[model samples]
Target: MQRLFGFMCLVLIATAVPASAQERLKVVASFSILGDFVRNVGGDRVSVTTLVGPEGDAHVYSPTPADAKKIADAKLIFINGLGFEGWLPRLVQSSGSKATVVTATTYITPLKLGSHADPHAWQTVVNAKTYINNIRVALSAAAPADAEVFKSNAEAYRAKLDALEGEIGQFIGQIPSHRRKLITNHEAFGYFAKEYGFEFIAPVGVSTEAEPSARDIAAIITQIKKAKIPAIFLENLSDPRLIKRIAAETGAKVGGTLYSDSLTDEKGDAPTYIDMVRHNIRTLRTALEGVTMRG
Candidate 1:
C-alpha cells in the first residue's frame, strides 16, 4: 500500500510539471523584424504570430479577417510605431482586441526629414538595443513567472548587437568619406546613413506608396551625374523600374537589392534582423568599393 501511494504521487507531479511548461503567452508582432525581436526575447515563453510575413510590404499591407482574429486571440501586440504601420490602428479597432500594445521604438529619438519622422529606427544598432530592452519589459509584465528568462535572453541578444555595431563601424570606416554617397529606391535608410556616416539619396519619400514626380527624377539624375555617385541600390520592397531608369540615365551601376521594411523568406540571405543589417552593409561596401577600385 505504501509503495502504491508513492508511485501515484510521482505520476501526478510529473504530469503537472509538463502542463505548466506548456502554457505559452500568445503574442502578435506587426511585422517580420519586430517578430524576430520578440522571438529572441520570449524564447519558449511565447508563441509569436506576425501579420506581415517575410518579404511582405507593411506600407500597403491589407489586414484580412484572419489577421483580425489573430489579434483578438493574442495576449500582447508589438508594433514598430512611428507611422510605419499606417493600417494598424484601424485593424486593432476592427478586431476589438484587448491585447496590450507595445511600441518597440518608443524611447528612441527620431530623425526627421523635412516634416516627416523617419520610422526606420531599427536601422541603427544602438536604437535596436532600446527596442530589445522595451520588449524585455513588456514580456516580463505579461509573464511575470518567466521574467528572468526574458531578461537573460535579452542580455545575450544585446551583446550580439554590440558586436554587430562594432563590425559595421569597422566596415564602413574602410570606405573613404568622399566615396560614401549612394542612391536607393526609397528614403528608408536615413537612420542607417546618419548612424554610419553615409549619404543616401532616394527618388521617393519615406513611404513606399509615395511616387516620385518627373521633377524628382530629373533632379536626382542631375545630382547623380554632378556628384559622380557610383552606386544605386534597389530595395527589396520597391519596384526596380524607377531605380533601373535612374541608373541607366546616370551611367551608375545597380549596386544590389537591400532589405528595407521587410525581411526575406527563410531560405534567402536576410532571414533574420541581424542577418539583414550585415547583408546590407556588406552589399554597400562591395559595390561602392568596387567602383573605387576601377576608378
Candidate 2:
C-alpha cells in the first residue's frame, strides 16, 4: 500500500507542472521580416505565426478572420510600426486580442519620405542590430525566466550582423561612385542608400499599393535618360511589367530581381535576412561593376 501511495504521489507531482512551462510562448509577427527576428531571438521558447508570409506585401495586406484568431491566441504581437501596417489597427480591434503589442523599430531614428516615415529601416544591417535588441528586450519582459537565453541569442545574432555590415562595406567600396546609381520599382531602399553611398530612383513611393501616374513614368524616364542610369531592378513584391516597360523605354538593362519588402521561401534565393541582403548586394554589384558609366 505504501509503495502504491508513493508512486501515485510522484505521478501527481509530475502533472502539477504548469501548462505555461510545458508549452512555448505564442507570438504573432506582422510580416516575414519581423517573424524572422522573433524566431532568432525567441528561439525554442516561442512559436511565431506570421500574418503576412514570405513574399507577401504588408502595406496592402487584408487581414482575415483566421489572422484575427491567431492574434487572439498570441501572448505578444510584434509589428514593424511607423505606419507600416495601416490595416493592423482594425484587425487588432476586431480580434480583441489582449496581447502586448511591441514595435520592433522602437529606438531607431526614422527616415522621412516627405510627410511619412519610411518603415524599411531593416534595409541596413546596422539598424537590424537595433531590431534584434528590441526583440530581445520584449521577449525578456514577457518571459523573465528566459531573459538570459534571449540575451545570449541576441548577442550572437548581432555579431553576425556586424560581420555582414563589414562585408557589404568592402563590396560597395570597390564600385565607383559614378556607377553607384540604380533604379527600383519603389522607394524601399532609402535607408540602404543612406547607410551605403548609392542613389536609388523609384517610380512609386514608399508604399507598394500606390499607382504611379503616366506623368510620373515620363519624368522617371526623362531622369534616367539625363543621368544615363545603367540598370533597373524588379522587386519581388512589385509588378515586373512596370520595370520592364521603364527599362525598354529608357534602354537601361533590366538588371535582376531584388527582394525588398519580403523574403522568399526556404527553397528560393533569399530565405533568411542575411541571404536576402547578400543576394541584393551581389545582384547590384554584378549589374553595376561591369557596366560602363555613361554621361
Candidate 3:
C-alpha cells in the first residue's frame, strides 16, 4: 500500500511540472554571418532561423512571403544593419513581427564605405567580438529568461574569436609587408585590410550592385604593375571577369578564392564564419608564399 502511495505521489509531482519547461526562445537573423553569431551566443537556449542561406549574396537578397511567417513568431531578430539589409524594414512591418530588432554593429566604430557605411564590419576578428557582445546583450533583453545562458555562451565564444584573431595575425605575419597590398573584385575586405595591415583596393565601390568603370579597372591594373602586386583576388560573390582581366593584363598571379559575401557549403572548405576567415587567410598565405596550402 505504501509503495502504491509513493508511486501516486511521484506521478502527481511529474504531472504538476509544466510541459513548456524546455520551450526555447525563437530568433531570426538577417543573414548567415549573424546567424552564426547568434548560434554562438544563444547556445541551446535559443532557436535561430537564417533568412540568407550559405553561399548566397545578401546585398541583393529579397525576402519571400514565407519569411514574414518566420519573423512573426520570433522573440528576437538580429541584423548587421548599416544599410546591409535595406529590405528589412519592409519585411519586419509586413510580417507584423513583434520581435525586438537589434543591430549587431551597434557598438562597432562605423567604417567608411565610399560615400556610404561599411556593412561588413564583422570581417575583422576584433569587430566580430563586439558584435558577439551586442548579440549577448540583445538576446538577454529580448528573452531575459535565458540571460545566464547568453552571458555564458558569449564569454566562451568570445575566447574562441580572440584565438581566431591571434591565429590570423600570426599567419599573415609570414608575408612580407610590401607584398601586403591587395586588389580584389569588391570592397568587402576594407575592414580586414585595415585590421590586418594590408591596403584593400577595389575597382567597385560599397555596393555590389554597381559596376567598376573601365578607367577604374585600368587604374588598378596600372597600380598593380607599378606596386608589383603579387596577386589579385576574386570575391566569392563577385563576377570573376574583372579580377581575371587584372591578372591577365598585369601578369599577376590570381590568388585563391576569398570568402567575402558568403560562406561555403557544409561539405566544402568554409562551412562556418570562423572557417571562412581561416580559409581566406590560408589561401592568401599559400598564394603569396608561392606554396600549396595543406588541409
The candidate scoring highest on TM-score is 1
Q: lDDT for model 3, on a 0 to 1 scale?
A: 0.84
Which has the greatest lDDT?
1
Candidate 3 Cα errors over 4 Å, as ranges: 1-21, 204-223, 235-249
lDDT of 1: 0.87
Cα error, candidate 3, residue 40 (Å): 0.9
State residue 146's C-alpha deviation in candidate 3, in Å: 2.1
**Candidate 2 steric clashes:** 0
Off by over 4 Å in 1: 1-21, 204-220, 235-251, 291-295
Kindly give the stretch of ten consecutive residues in candidate 3 with the minimal lDDT sum.
203-212
Write the number of the candidate with greater TM-score, choosing between 1 and 3. Answer: 1
Per-model TM-score versus the true fold: 0.86, 0.85, 0.85
Model 2 residue 56 lDDT? 94
Instruction: State candidate 1's TM-score.
Output: 0.86
Give lDDT tens digits, candidate 3, residues 169-254.
87899989888876676778888988888877764332344665677677777888887888877443256777678788998777
| lDDT scores of the candidates, listed in order | 0.87, 0.86, 0.84
lDDT of 2: 0.86
